[model samples]
Target: MGGTVTLRRALLATTAATVLAFLPNTAQAAVSYPDPQPITGQQIIHDPTVVRLKSGGYVAYSTGGVIGARLSKDLKHWDDAGNAFAEPPSWWYEYNDTGDPWAPDISYRDGTYWLYYAVSSWGTNHSAIGVATSPSGRPGTWTDHGKVFTSEKTDTWNAIDPAIIKTDGRLWMTFGSYWTGIRMVQLDRTTGKAVQGATVHHLATRPDAPYAVEGPYIVKHGRYYYLFASYDQCCAGVNSTYKIRVGRSTSVTGPYVDSTGKPLLEGGGDLLLEGHGRYIGTGGESVFRAKGHDWLAYHYYDADDEGTPKLGLNQLHWKENGWPIAL
Candidate 1:
């Protein structure tokens, strides 16, 4: 889910690269590597989920009114295709006054392209996660499937920030934000909705007051299932403390742990990305596997651009030791 950005924070932090030198705790876990890989095509998006087109191109969808969409044939040149919704769905108005969908997720299921998004207002847990289907994976072709799950302000956990992955021949969705942490439930393969018989499992959380962890994206690699998420404060523009973290477990419904063997439920995670130089608040991410490489898709606030959030992609390289590193 997109966090609320404060206009004032954008004014406070100018050189994100400089502040990391003083984040003592992150020193042991966060990568210190420079962002040397070239990223081309300037465009703006948030919580973007990307799927490669059959034509060897890539299409991305993200959170916004009618859902912002973009396409790229070669990763170097980007074209704003338009919003995924030709007109705002009537259902979204129940949760979001502006009809802006958040944290859109895309995946291929059988012969269909499935997109899942959150219809929710900022700072409130009153929300709904809706599903849509597209035959060609294009913007206007999508048919909204209505609500998959809904959470109220009285619920124990906020339901938002959805990521769906097919593992062990079953589809599972993990979602939550700023409530009781990350939660997962099984989805009916036929309907792509939560299986009524399956139990909801609480996956990860931060025990502190605000418990600032959310945006769960899981990927199975080798024998382990890696869980990635955002941690700390977000949406504060340049002062956004959002960063990506990872934990792993042998089971999909996990007891995931970080590099230090601490359980994710206890706030354990190995830092992946944080603000550095102009790349501020790098989180709300998704992973896509193609060409023998895993690509991380997310958003970052560009300090040079007055903290405007934009899309980001980087290759994940697994070290000989089996840990993933952004190279």
Candidate 2:
């Protein structure tokens, strides 16, 4: 996610009074809207994944500092918990000398919390997927599990945004951003590592789109695997044109399709969200269902002030056709 500051036109004196006068009536009306809450601690918090901890509190992890953690009770207000993985693993420094921590996906299974992160330079094919572990999803107590997958510098496809899904007693990882498109590989459950003989399968791509497609996240609901991704350039301030798009398939390794029956593998995706209001370039989505409602956490460039990218959270509602619409 990026950092941004949005400046709304200050309410005029008359408008303020009018709004206040109708506030009580509006509050009594049927629909209730969630107030926008800003999360602190880091300037940019991208690719955020929020999970309900065993203790009932919430832990949110995102890119930057190999992943930063924040805690919340009500899910609206957040308190920074600091960087989860501050020190780069020895192998990471040995290979790249510097760590460009991108997207991180955290999950709990088999008595441990697994953190899958991407290490690579922006817009480059030189990247690798790695795993880390923590007894609990807290800060300052993670152990790196070395590299899981790597892309050759010669390959066009860059591997990043590692999201893991466990199904039918097997673990599978979906990854890839720039260069080629989204790819997936099976992972060893015990080690949280890629299986030796597993080959990366091309899951989705949009090479012909205006820009490269990336930031692949998957959420399985009902009988379908929902594949969500950001399309176009991100982090370009006001000029950025990033937006979230999605498709779904019955099978994990799919020929996913949009509502209009366009296949994702064939460069088809239904638009989930785009820029609006003072927000520009909204993408890099991570979805969570909490309090009986779906919420979308993503980053976007704030355009009101000098454009800065920042994390954004909004409620997600599903249309009758099974597609998500962010409010």
Candidate 3:
């Protein structure tokens, strides 16, 4: 999510291949992207999830106290709607000094809107995932449902960056940041928490040092389910190397492979979008279908604006081979 990143961490070393993303001689060189749409008013957001409300407006939830909110009638322009919580949720203080939440996931089912969020200390495995439900999906009406899942200091996986997908009548949440990459678990449809006995499934990881993959978002197209994630460092203004990458599988739960036959479990992926011109470290995304198009909504550091975080939207298209490409 958008926060102050020290210069040292923002300049972390990139893997050999990711280094090629910026060099002209490398085969893995990035695919050029058209300039991202310039968002106006109430533009600061991190790890944003945009959802269209039934009442006919758009709501965007992001990282911070009460799960920071922004509302828009047209999605092109936005206005700050204050935090989703009127007061702090005491439970979140167990993991972080502030009862602030981060990386919220927004979804609606059975006439109720569900907002899943994370609480954690920066760069630590200690974290908890929580949920709140709203009757109208508007700010100030959500009720905190408390922790859905959590990770401790000893756990290999960090529990943050939550995203959910309902497939085959089941709701599954995908989360994690630094520790063991991205992991998923099934949630009880009735409670929106982890199913009593369901196992946590590992989805993606980088074996090399400074693994750096996070922000897992899954979306299905045609007959395949695709996993989207951020690669490398983020929150570093224009210095952040974060980019969106993708892999696919016919089954949502197992064995996601990239375009070149590399498994995501071992860091395989096909590039979707990367830095271009004023847009740098373009990642931390959410995907949703709108008006017959699949949209990849993410945040980017605007190089021209003192490297501040801003909302970025791009139309995602699928190829004949079924791979997702961001335009």
Candidate 4:
């Protein structure tokens, strides 16, 4: 979900261009990505995952400052809410020297908030995704629950950028990065960790090297499971090549395919959003429902602001064919 400006040269430009070139005629003919809605105050963030709190308003956690947090009472103007944790748990040090966590997914169920995030040093596959619980879904209210999953140097899949989706009474986590793209495993609802002997399902990957795909977020719409993932380089300020793409499948664990019936495992996904105008490197996305509408939350490097990463929010609209468009 993160990389230096140097990694921006990884394999993705051609892949993204190919995908967009083959977009459905309906979409391609009218292809104009929308700009994120304007917002005020504390717009800085990366890899943002958002949740609507029952207590009120919304809380967003992203990659930085002990899981950086932001608050929005009306989903417009935002204020820095401080880090989610006052201090990292002792276990976080095992993965990163600074205990710095990244790419958190927040969900509310059964009267509590569950937060899943990754801890790893840059440019390595040795990583771990951990879980925590919060009573209020606010900063400073979390209780760290340690690792839900991990990936050693020997593992092909890097277990970062964790996102959770519950389907048919089963809890599943989808994660991975440059090593092998997106993967999924069932989680025990009780422990919020991988289920004993669970099979890790391959969800998405690129046909090229460095994979260049990360930050997966899945949501079910109609009869299909839509997999949204960030592709190409990120964290490189204005030089970042990050963009968002999508594919869908009839099953939760898929062989997901883009609008053209191409498998995501083979670098197939419909273009959703990418850097445009002042909004550069539009990726690291998460989707949530609030006030009877679906919204896509992500981060973009601001070309107008010295390439500082900032929050990007857009309403999601599903076409008659069930593909989603960010507006």
Best by lDDT: 4
- Report residue 78 deviation for candidate 1 (angstroms): 1.1
Q: After the best TM-score superposition of candidate 3, give how far the Cα of residue 129 lies from its true spot, in angstroms.
A: 0.3
Q: What is the TM-score of each candidate against the true structure?
A: 0.89, 0.83, 0.90, 0.92
Kindly give the stretch of ten consecutive residues in candidate 3 with the minimal lDDT sum: 8-17
* Prediction RMSDs, each to the true structure: 7.9, 8.0, 8.3, 8.1
Better of 1 and 4 by TM-score: 4
What would the per-residue lDDT of candidate 3 be over residues 1-327, giving only the tens digit for each residue? 334443332343123324443443213444346455546789888889989889988899998557889998876799999989998789989988878788899999999999999999887888999999999999999999999999998888999999999999999999989786989999999999999877989889998855789999999888899999999999999899999888889988868988788899898887778888888998999997776778889999989999988888876756546776565
| Decoy 1 TM-score against native | 0.89
In TM-score terms, candidate 4 sits at 0.92
Candidate 4 — what's its lDDT?
A: 0.90
Off by over 4 Å in 2: 1-44, 209-211
Winning candidate number (TM-score): 4
lDDT of each residue in 1-327, candidate 1, tens digit only = 123343333332223323433444335345364342344664787888989876578899988658888888876567888888898889889997788789989999899999999988888999888899988888888999898887898888888999998988999999989887999989988888888867778889997857799889999888889999999877888989899998989999999988778899998988877778889999889998766778888888889999888888877766444556564
- So what's the TM-score on candidate 2? 0.83
Model 3 score (lDDT)? 0.84
Q: lDDT by residue for model 2 over 1-327, one digit each (tens)?
A: 132233231233224334434432212123222222456544356678777777788788887665777888877567878887777776665335576577888889998988888887755677888888988778788888888888877975777888888987889998888666888999999998989989778878875743378888888877888899988888788998888888999988887887668888778887767777677888877877677877788877777767876768776655444555554
- Give the lDDT of residue 43 in candidate 2: 37
Candidate 4 colliding pairs = none
Sorted by lDDT (best first), the order is 4, 3, 1, 2
Q: After best superposition, candidate 3 residue 228: deviation in angstroms?
A: 0.4
Instruction: Give candidate 1's error at residue 204 in angstroms.
Output: 0.7
- Tens-digit lDDT string for candidate 4 (1-327): 346642542344334334545555237426577778778989999999999988899999999999999999988889999999999999999998999999999998778899999999999999999999988999999999888989999988999999999999999999999998999999999989999888989989999899999999999999999999999999999999999999999999998999889999999998899999999999999999987989999999999999999999987877657888776
